[model samples]
Target: MKKEYAVIGLGRFGGSICKALSEEGLEVMAMDMNEDRVNEYAKIASHAVIGDSTDESVLKNLGIRNFDHVIVAIGENIQASILTTIMLKELGVKMVTVKAQNDYHEKVLNKIGADRIVHPERDMGRRIAHKIISNNVLDYLELSDEYSLIEIVANSRLAGHSLLDLDIRARYGINIVAIKRGKEVIVSPLADEMIQKEDILIVIGAVADIGRFEKREMQNDY
Candidate 1:
């Protein structure tokens, strides 16, 4: 069955998600209090409506609880965000993902049983910082405070070396879960597979261990 999604507050974050989901042929309900915002997404979403999600009656009218997932992306208005999230959970929505303005906002969302809390600004800053500090790191995703998944470009030093030869798991405590070469992706790569320059390694491990691996194996090698 196809999962349905409701996105409250048609701002950058919510708008982007609606567009992406719609592009993938998913059913998306885009809502916002602002008529202009709702109109903007009318052609892009499966359904777009001008409604304030903070109002329990409004959400009920939209049948938001029936959606498989609801994303609360109300910007600046922290109170509205909290209220909307609480209402969605209470109404028995399967999942509620919210955007937190800050640490205190995230704490409240966690206490209220939000399924996911996103700090886009903070997370993007961390990703950009990692990329700035290491030329090898192409992208970064934080799985938790302690763990992360990163994509790194293979350099000359790592080229021609097999996973067994590098012993990355034993030495760095990081696993190359996948390798992206050109347009192909090899998941759960074999130990004997040789790494070549320009290959992009998708690795996952503790954040500290990943940093150490980048410093010792990638940065120092060149």
Candidate 2:
């Protein structure tokens, strides 16, 4: 069965999601307060409506509760975002994801029962900053405040060393979850598998440990 998604706020964030969801054949209802924005997404999404999402009556009329997942993507207008999220939960929406402007807004949304909170700007900024700072860091993702999943180029010195030889888990307290070589990806690599220079290691560990490993491993190469 095709899933249904509702995206409130026709800003870049919400508009992009609606377009992608519709392109993938999911049922998407794009809602925004601006008629122009609603019209822009009309052809992209399954349905598009211009209405104030903070209004419970409008939401009820639109059957917002029927959507499998609702995304509150309102920008800067934290009040409207909070109100819409509260109304959606009150209407018994199964799942609600809100785009938060800050940590305080996220805390408030969570307390009001938002199922998920997204910090798009902050996340993107972090990823970009990491790329700028390190030439060997291909990508970075935060799994939690304390831990992260990072993709780093295999150090030349560490090349040809097998997982068993390094014993990363016991030695560095980090896990080599995956190895991406060119187009190929190896998940849960074997203990005897050697690290090739072509390999991009997907490691998960505490932020500090990962930083230490990067410095110790890639310092000379960079």
Local distance difference test values of all predictions, in order: 0.94, 0.91
> Candidate 1 on 61-130: residue-level lDDT in tens?
8888899999999999999999999999999998999999999999999999999999998999999999
Model 1 gets an lDDT of 0.94
Q: What would the per-residue lDDT of candidate 2 be over residues 116-171, giving only the tens digit for each residue?
A: 99998999898887777667888999988899999988977679899999888887
Which residue pairs clash within candidate 1? Answer: none
| C-alpha lDDT of candidate 2 relative to the true structure | 0.91
User: For model 2, how many clashes?
Assistant: 0
* Candidate 1 local Cα displacement, residue 40, angstroms: 0.6
Q: By how many angstroms RMSD does model 2 differ from the true structure?
A: 1.5
Error of 1 at 142 (Å): 0.9
